[model samples]
Target: MRQSGTVGFWRWRRNPLKRRSDVVEAWVLLIVAVLMLCGLPLAGVLAGLHVDDELQHQREERQRTTAVLAEDARAWQAGRYARYQATVRWKASDGTEHTAVADVGPESRAGSTTSIWTDGKGELTGEPPTEAQAASAAALAGVLTMGGAGALVLGAHWVVRLSLDRHRAVALDQEWARVGPQWGTRHA
Candidate 1:
């Protein structure tokens, strides 16, 4: 009698009808399982560590300093956000003066003092991320990396499965062609 349900480990068991393609497919599934369980998480952790290190380095290189607005800071609307832009001047660690246009508080006016971040060259730069922000960024990086890797692995597995299916279909068709004539003659 024909089996109504699938047999467990049929691919690995010694069956007369089992083809080489079945063995290959079973091995593919095993490898995919291993990668999903172990390899993907390792890649995610490495990616997160790399992002955290880079962010920490950037935070270390940034310097906070007080600057005086050289011109009145005019508030402007940008989409859902509001900002005040004005020219500001500050002295660098080398005692050289630098002037640039930057964003300031809405209440800031000419000659008002404000805090700003600068790079080692005394060029105005955005403030680096805080510890919390860096941690969040690292976590986001890790999750995204894991998601991307998982997608790639699953896609590859799908392709392999599709190819195996097609191969099995062709083999079945060839076998049917070879045996069908004999059965027809016996029936006649």
Candidate 2:
């Protein structure tokens, strides 16, 4: 009962048995706990906000336009994207026309219409992510930020633990140096 109840007694109680290293380590553990609980979530929130802002900027800058395949293009893969590739032509805001290779679906054929995305220069580009995609990306960013912050704090805690252990070892060596000589003069 005594051993189980005294688990953290050295850290929580004031006694001659509590060395300076013990006190420092206890304070460090408390700080780490606070940071892991508070700072990690804060980092995740900040990262999510940042991702949303960037996605919004992209949504504002990119434009969707109608394009036509210059020739029949077959499916490059059976997936949603890159189902096919073909020379696609679209008009710019100034009525200038441009051509670029584009990913299309199997339904595309010569002279058939399809929607495409373009940049400020009217060059073909990938479409901006939908609201769902933006939200998913934000969520992923938040998770990654939290994980990275946790890893950093955990590493710092490990370093602090190692430093405290080294100090404890040095203290033990010093104490033994003073008491070691007394053992030679003892009768027993």
Q: Pick the candidate with the highest lDDT.
A: 1
Measured against the true structure, the TM-scores of the candidates, in listed sequence, are: 0.84, 0.77
How would you encode candidate 2's per-residue C-alpha lDDT over 10-69 as one tens digit per residue? 587868787888888889999999999999999999999999999988888899999989
Kindly list the per-residue Cα lDDT of model 1 for residues 93-174, writing each as its tens digit.
9999999989898889999999999998899999999999999999999999999999999999999999999999999999
RMSD of each: 3.4, 3.9
| Candidate 2 least-lDDT 10 residues | 74-83
